[model samples]
Target chain A: MTALPDTTGKKLGLVIDLDTCVGCQACATSCKEWNTQGYSAPMTDRDPRGSDPDGPWLNRIHGYEIEPESGHDSRVVHFPRSCLHCETPACVTVCPTGASYKRAEDGIVLINPDTCIGCKLCSWACPYGAREYDVDHGVMKKCTLCVDRIYNENLEPEDRQPACVKACPTGARHFGDLGDPGSAVSQLVLERGGFDLLPEMGYKPTNKYLPPRTKRNTPQAGIEALPKGDGSAMDRLFKLADRLLSGAGN
Target chain B: MNPAYSVIFFTTASGAGYGLLALLGLTGARMGHAPSLLFAILTLIIALGLITAGLLSSTLHLGRPERAWRALSQWRTSWLSREGVAAIVTYPFALAFGLVWSGLVAIPDAVAPLGILTAILALTTVFTTGKIYATLTTIRAWNQPLTVPIYLFFALASGGALHWAISTILGMEPGTVPPVAGFALLMLAMLKLRYWGLIDNAPRDRTMANATGLGEHVRQWEVPHTSTNFVQREMGFVVARRHAQRLRKIFFLLLLLAGGLEGAATSVPAFAVPAALILLIAAWLERWLFFAEGEHVVTLFYGNPNA
Candidate 1:
């Protein structure tokens, strides 16, 4: 049913670390690779080789420049975005058909390919834009949290996890039962002070994002350590040249 | 928020249809003398035709139109499903009322009760339609108390205008329809102006920083994709403020013209049809603006400073 359950037996979700993500597309590509052929087959790249290739992808990584209010130096942060599988997901409840639903046992939201009419209401209901419209199949697709491989007895036990989590070279993506406070993922969240995205929206997202940590030795500190040059004409000229060159961006 | 033509057409057409049905049901039993068979047939045909055509047009944008029937199964939670169910239920009430009013069934006592029931169902269907957009919290512009009231007011105004034109065209006395329609048009104009003001001044707190859970001064350095994706195309649609201002002016001007013409029609019947047409055009512009101005929260991740 589209109506959400009162509670789930286990909140199986991912915890993404924004500090370690390198803006690499490994998680996104790996998610596409596994999901396209596994459950929700043929993720449908409308024009793969064309100048403007477009397709449905379950995960995407974005880059941002953060200039903190405090004296923390400005830095670039890479963020990986995906479905949070909220406890009270509007995407599931807004589905006119009973296609979009959250699993009562594990709390992972999934859309039934056979029943989705592709009205795109679920996509509209999502604040994170996690729902992807499959143009070829005329249905909605999204991150299933690797439900197929996560429980497959055929695969090696170590390989049983979400493709995105398994493929993260930096170990930025952690997956486990979030409902249990003693779980490793939950402990990581507690230690890092992991926070929910758009918390004011009040969906109570299951997944959490660990914010980037501040650098101990900032560029300003390093600049202060440099020796003060003797107040010579050539020194002033060199300083002017250095200032002009610094304004140019890569 | 992309303002798909199919949905715009569906809502406007069906909204007006339901409004007309409700009004007809309210006034049907009071008409002491039964109108000619031709008039009755024509009115019912126009109302039902607009409704059926609208319902069909709604499916045009669906990915799997064959599975559209499944939409009616989740009314327990979904406003869209409730709308479907209410719309289907209205059909039977409408048909029964149509038969009695047209003298085809000749059950005089059944007319009043059936008419009341039909009117209630028709209004409920329109209410459900309004809730579909109002309940969606992702789009800040649409998730408001005023949204549903605007929808209801537009329906009554447009439907009232249509009724005036039909009555005048069929040689029936226009009676209080002209004034009632004029009043509805004036009220709609006021409500719409207030709605615009509310949306413009509403606090937009959903920023890129909060949306991504990054620090307060976050700025998007790079998009996730080279080309625009479905989310951008669907929810990131933005309308220039200058163009929207011009359109708002055009909307009010059209509304004024419709109201003046509707008022004039009471004396000179020639103005009635033109008045209705002008009101419909105005309503369509309003509907288009409704979708175009909507700001979805997802757009914040795509570098929209605020939603």
Candidate 2:
């Protein structure tokens, strides 16, 4: 089996286009299904057969209704939160057992389950809450960025993608080498002004987010003077004339 | 910062055991208690053992056992590291104290050379335990200015209780146990009351809007993700305000019964021995809730209600 080019010596990451994301939750559902059975440790939901249920899951999406400007209609931006695979992951440095570490090769933060003690200290250290305790196995787990799948060469090159990226029906999630400026993900980021979450925390997140953009054409200046459809024909005509004048800054 | 029941008991119980011993070693020079030497030695060991066991149990949760030494190197930045260092340094001093104790010998005019070691070690142990809590900036409950003082008080209270209990068990008269036990209980009560007040007045840092970091007047209509993730499970733990109030009441009752037992006791030995143990458990419960009730600063980011 031909191995994909070494992601080593490069920082691999995701560029999530928030503008296009529909918040269908397809990515989250697909992730749970794939990682649960496919990955070594599935998210254990305690009390699944009853109420007061709690368990460990790797990726969680936080929904926010953001009204950035005052007196504006709110928009729900589906924030699919996961480990950003930071350049300097707080979780990595805080791990006492060296179980949690940022791969020197790819910059993807990963947990070496053998070394983890499940102290959950690494979880507390992380501001993103990316780490979860696998109660069944007694270890911390997180998004591997599909390190297992992305590099696997057994499947077609196009088929190799992170489960979340694969399952994103809206095509909001992109995976590639962020280091290369010419890469599709990188170019998209550069063009759209993708940003990192909680930038001030200074983890230097590898993942980037494309900001939400407004819809429709640029309205002419003073376009608000134009009257909406009304019953008074003469009044509407006069308002149109006024709008034309205001459009020219008269 | 769950403040696992075991750890809560371990730290407070162990701190008191060791802390009182350190005190006994320091004042052994002036006091005429026969077991001053014996108690001090036993306590130093007990404290060291408590700390060792706590450290060991904490490590049991780690994925990598062999790499434990790497943790100590990060003391400059990590509280866990600082805690480890302080504990290790204190252990040797504590051990040296027990070893060099000459108070056990017939020549008891002046105190042993180890008294100084003990005083330093006791202070160190108390600070280390407190630092462990104070370092957690995420848990608003623990990440307070009061964590250190509360820890110090517990150590004293537990030590007082342990001293009271041990002295009573050993048939030490009122000359030692009552005053220390009384002082310990009072100090412990004061700290608990102050902590209760601190939490009551603990101002909320974020509203729903500020937490989402979108605007000042924001409300979460829907969560972005379909499945639950780590942040929600870990940082988003919010205890109901009513439960917190109920907890406060229980804290008050326990404090009254446990911390106030010494003054109500008819006999120092008879009352102190049992009462101190009861209060230790109460102090422990208080510590656990202090952790569980603590709201992490990060919880605000997700629009979770502040506890």
Tens-place lDDT digits, model 2, residues A1-250: 0111234477799998878888777877777677777554666777766645566656666666666464345577776777888776667765555556677677778877665666677777666677778777677888888887888898789878988999998899999888888899999999998887656556778888887786444344574564466658887888899899999995
Residue B1 local lDDT, model 2 = 40
* DockQ score of each predicted structure, in the order shown: 0.65, 0.18
lDDT of 1 by residue, B183-290 (tens): 778888898888888889999988887898886788999899868999999998877888889999999999999888877876799898999899888888888988
TM-score of chain A of 1: 0.86
The TM-scores that each candidate's chain B achieves against the reference are 0.97, 0.83
lDDT at A223 for candidate 1? 38
| C-alpha RMSD over true interface residues, each candidate | 1.0, 6.8
TM-score of each: 0.93, 0.73
Candidate number achieving the greatest DockQ relative to the actual structure: 1
